[model samples]
Target: MLMKTIFKLLAVALLFASCDDVEPTIYNGNIGQNDTFLSFSRSVYLLPVVQNQTGEVKVVFNSSTVSDVDRVYNIEVGFPEASPANPETFTVPASVTIPAGEYQGSFTIPGVDNGLVDEVVKRFTLTVTNLSDNEYMDNDTTTINIYEVCPLQADFLGTYTIQVASEPLGISAFEAGEVTLVEGDSQYERVFNATVYPGYGGNQQVTLAFACNFLNLGQSIDTNVTCDVEDDTKSLVHAPAELADRSAYDTNDDSYFELTFIEDSQSDCGSPANTVLTFTKVE
Candidate 1:
């Protein structure tokens, strides 16, 4: 009797251990017929412009069995239905191989700056072609967006003294103080935090882009300061000035440039459009 009990306990322990070692099989739901599937790790990819102007896209092999030898899969890269990117602007690999005992691999996509317009996003599609008699799963296709980007120019980033040169909404909406300009997404943009309305109790990150001294004001940011007593949902807003003169920056002197913006431009506060805050650099 004692021996039988010990054997039963050992059997239960082994059963639990085996269950712990089992790996879950996540097949593409579109094709439940197959035990193995090939999929892109992401549905969308942003190709960052690096030193070589190239980026890698990861491909994952979802299978319970790991092969001892490398497995190669064919891929097709083409433009989507309409408004496809220029064929000459980008290049992708024809095939990617997963190494022995590895479940994932990556393929390099070379960025070709062949007259590609800066800041224009172009899209291309990548599909894994070897699955289930050429029938692809939903996850097998991935879209990639590429754009021409110039390197960040270092001269524009730093701390500078700021003060309102013009206020169309009200007085003291922004205080005269120092603010820092940091790097933005592309070479033409800069980001900074300004407390446009202290009564609202938060500083909003302001991003502005410029080309040839012409300013591109970013979207309005929510100050979360409700001006309407009836509607708590309505809050004050701040954005780069839409005014023509203040919107333009002075390229002749970066040390003394100006930032203009409208406070309560949306008229959330009853006194909207009363102030347009223009900040001039002092440093």
Candidate 2:
């Protein structure tokens, strides 16, 4: 009889302990907000340099509230103080209209290749105006850049003997061996892989940009080849060594081409200036 009474007492305690209130988690903040605004999708747009081509720059308008009527907004185009875009090279629309029951719309800025120079980048600005019903967002204005490019007249795709023609600092950038040239994503570009440092494990992807008889190493590449064993900070880097007179190719000749680049461009080890490499097409 005493054991039965003890079991009943323990059951009553457990039941009372499970009855404590949890108190629902009260959220003291708003779940969402409704905002209406208009702005450009991007701050900068780069148009390709193909001849007789037209590029499109898109603008986006955003809104949270829907209406039964169309919403119209005005746009103003202007040129920056330095390196302004020529008026004849591009066209911008004065206004854009968004249909009702839509949250977004897009408009294009038509950029023509006329009057665009081969090596120069032209810039223009577009600003949103006369938006009475919607607020202008952070990126209200956007800049567009246009340039000219010469089409590839001939193919330079083949294996070639690449040699370190000029290494002023006597640091051999690569082993004089055969490297294959392949077509890049565009007609004005050719890509190859080579070891920029003597003992680097892998080859680095290198791009050569050609424009109107002018060619250069497209951009800087990280070799990951350190100068010293103890110093991880000092590494060899390669970048475009653009020589006005020498860094060029003959469009009529596909047999050979030369490229120049800077080894240890930032002088991580020392002042190793221009490293000129020659590529002779292999028959």
Candidate 3:
């Protein structure tokens, strides 16, 4: 009878302890937010289709975290590169969600005139509080990189007209039929290259190099009319009255006369020398 009573008393004590160990109800408690929260995935953006000559960069926002958050809060984007030399721009949205949700807004990037922009994202952490008691809550961070693209240009490409042997060249024997310049399959930047080829020396077999630069054009082209041996014996051909000048032939030298239109003297023609001449232009 005594052992039975002792066992019954121990049982009653254990029942009361178990009943008192039950947890209390959390009736809309402010201390219920005791979990770990973190936000990542920040990126820079280059807005395309922007044709601003001043080299200003426009950025776009992608905030997809707040909607999954448990508390009612507000998130704002800011730049740390703020204050006289390193000031940042941070414009907040008009309102915050009483129950916390994702939000967005836009503002211009100012004071950057150097055409080079390396923008860093400045994020403002959203704080949560009890609707009844405005208490501080936990926070998270994110970032973005904004930049500008420069323009490019290549070189000068075009065409030009050319002329070789343009002004004139003097060949003592042959007549200058034509004066023309040909590019010869190769494309030259300049229309006329007076130094490239020393072309058209009508001497020998007609294959002369273009090594010379200066050109000689005859002012007057005519024929030396020899009076068929009879005029040579009479010596009536080289009279100063018939020709233009006496200097056409230098009696002091035995070389042939190389005369221009303005230099012709009626005294230059003799029955012993008869030859026809022609002329043209080359640039």
- The residue-by-residue lDDT of candidate 2 on 188-257, one tens digit each, is 6678887664544346667776766777765566566654556565556777664453377888787988
Tens digits of per-residue lDDT for model 3, 1-283: 1111110101122211122111222223333352222222112222211123322222222222233444433444455443112223222343234233432223233323243332221222222222334332122332322222222121111222222222111212233343223321111100111111123211111110110111112111222322233343221111111122212322232122222222122332211222222222222
Per-residue alpha-carbon lDDT of candidate 1 for residues 205-271, written as tens digits (9 for 90 to 100): 6666554444544445555554455665565566545435444555555665555556666776544
- Give one clash count per candidate, in the order shown: 10, 1, 25
Cα-based TM-score, every candidate: 0.46, 0.54, 0.20
Error of 3 at 197 (Å): 61
Clashes of 3: 25
Runs off by more than 4 Å, candidate 2: 1-48, 51-114, 121-147, 228-230, 243-246
- Candidate 3, position 106, lDDT: 31
Candidate 2: deviation at residue 200, Å?
3.5
Local accuracy by lDDT, each model? 0.54, 0.62, 0.24
- Whichever of 1 and 2 has more TM-score, that candidate is 2
**Which candidate comes out best when scored by TM-score?**
2
- Stretches off by above 4 angstroms in model 1 are 1-154, 240-246, 271-283
The reply for model 3, stretches above 4 Å from the true place, is 1-72, 76-139, 150-283
- Kindly provide the TM-score of model 3 when superposed on the true structure, using C-alpha atoms: 0.20
lDDT of prediction 3:
0.24
